[model samples]
Target chain A: MKIRVNGEGVQLKQPIQTVEELLHHLNLEKKSLIIEHNHIILKKDQHRESQVSDGDQFEIVHFVGGG
Target chain B: MLSDNRYHRQMLFEPIGEAGQRSIQESHVLIIGVGALGSSSSEMLVRAGVGKITLMDRDYVEESNLQRQQLFSEEDVKNQTPKVIAAKNRLQAINSHTIIEAKVIDVGVEELDSIAEEVDVIIDATDNFDTRLIINDICQKYRKPWVYGACVASYGVTFTVLPDETPCLQCLMDHIPNDGATCDTVGIISPAVQMVVAHQVTEVIKLLTDNQDALSGKLIAFDLWKNQQMELKVATLKDENCPSCSQAKYPNLEYQAQVKTAVLCGRNTVQIRAGTQKNFHFIQFKEHLKDLNLTNFFSNPYLVSFEIDPFRIVVFKDGRTLIHGTKNPQEAKKLYYRFVG
Candidate 1:
């Protein structure tokens, strides 16, 4: 299934079911990540329960250190 | 004293009209860490005619900083002028009317408390999480608004935290853990710093000019090289149990009471503020250095820079020592104690 990540479309190898799984696939599960799935802020607890579908947009951001 | 028509072009803008210009002129902004972001944002604030700008930075100017740090020059690097002093010197030249204050001390909880409450807004121009978290905690305690911004490589991110209204940095701290690249590791471009500064200074203008409603409530991010931009809405990110904003328990403030030692992110420098040496005699210390056979060193009115092979130790009047050539706080502490003790 193809899912939009940060405005770019990416295809999942398997049918990824949840936001937590997507984070795992992206190897960012352990990261302190704030995910916006379908334009909604998904809390950390909701990552496990929130389901992802094909063509859904996600905006993921984490703080970068510098200045 | 602002000359009439000095800010005529800026006053022409609709939002910051004559009244807003006066508001801008009457405002006082405290910017921490006069690095790329600090120098750039402070410049915009100064040019926009902010009444008073107090710049705080511990590090001195280096040749590497001139690429993005707009205020410094070869002369500043030659003299090893502190970042805040160099930035203030340039800022004062741009607009003689604006009051540019410079503090060369390393920022800690005690330093923040002394000035945070008085400023209209605080800009996070620091390069490390420890400093930013401290700024976050202190801003929460004083109930003052602060703009959070960071950039590395070709990417930048920023958000404004309005104490009670928005999710403070502590609330988002866990989610935004320190795992990204740094300027020293991946290197940084001028555009990344400029992008973040644009947002930071804009937030400052909105806060000062009574246009708080126009402030961007989203977490703005940019990847200049990849041409990516994201403004993530973070209303739900506010943790009600946050010790910083919710509980009025500023745990970061307690840090000042402890022994202060921190790695100045990516700078290959460690600052150790072990104890206060109220009456530090530079001439006596220079004589002491000579006795120890430490030959390569320089001393100015502000600090004594001593080089002992790999490490260049800069001793301040108050026993604060910046040990360059090592990033280890423990090593820095060891060297500091060996010398200062």
Candidate 2:
């Protein structure tokens, strides 16, 4: 499956069904992220249930600790 | 005529013509935190002729702050000037006609409520989410508008929250991300700070001049290093179950006994928050400290700090203290009680 992450194209060799799977595949800390799937923000609890399909766009914003 | 001539160029702009300029001159804005984003936004507001501004910050000016924070000088560092005081002096010099109020105290719910009621708009230039959330709660309760801006490294993000009209910060960010990457750790570029403030101040002007249609309702994010920009449409991001806007439950504001002792990200410093808000008289504290054989002691109207071997303790007027040279919250709390109590 291929999808766009932060405006970059990424190819997943294995099938990624949910937002949680994609985050896990990318080795990202789930707690330290604000994920937008298909232009809609997903609550942390919805990460596992939110489905990710081919050609989907994801924006994962990391909060930085500064003024 | 001379007073009006000062803003002649801004008056020429059709959007902010003489009437809009007058509106700008009649507005009041409160800015929290005088760090990078705060300093830049405050400078722009003063130059733009905002009638009055109240600056609230607890930190002092350090040499490291000179790089991105524009409203400070080497003298501020040498004097250990509080950020609000230094910013007020610089902003006043820039526009003496504009009223600048500096408060060197931590802004919790009680302080925010009174200040929010007095100001037309608020700017979130704070470093932490805790303060931002409190701002959101108070702004929502008062039906005031505020601009939220944050920057770290080469990236920055901003959003404007108009009470009762748009989603508050709590509506957009259900959970606060504790990523622990601060400018003190990852480093910040000057341009990133400029870009964030540019957007924030522009929104502020639009709101003040009654140009509500011109305000960007979406969340704006930019990364100068990566050359990426994003406009996340947060118009429909309001959660019905939000504790702030929906349920009208302000946990952040109501939780007053918050004894927050946490290690500042990447600074090797621990902030020992005041268990309760108290008025700390700096002069009295300084006078009492004269008997103690403490070296390198400094006293200002806003705060007082003393060097105790490897540790340096800075006690603010609000009783909150920042303990440098240690990351342990327990150690910071111990020092706070021993020295401050």
Worst 10 residues of 2 chain B by lDDT: B274-283
Task: Provide the lDDT at B25 for model 2.
Answer: 92
lDDT by residue for model 1 (B131-168), tens: 88899899988889999999989989999999888998
Positional deviation of residue B147's Cα in model 1 after best superposition, in angstroms? 0.5
Scored against the true structure, residue B85 in model 1 reaches a CA lDDT of 78
Residue B218: error of model 1 in Å?
1.1
TM-score of chain B of each: 0.94, 0.95
CA error at residue B188 for candidate 1, angstroms: 0.9
Pairs that collide, model 1: none
Candidate 2 is scored at a TM of 0.93
Among the numbered candidates, top TM-score falls to: 1
Report residue B258 deviation for candidate 1 (angstroms). Answer: 2.9
Candidate 2, pairs of clashing residues = none
State interface RMSD in Å for all models: 1.8, 2.3
Tens-place lDDT per residue, model 2, B234-327, is 6676778888888888767875767888677778889877666556665778788877868888877767789887999888777788999999
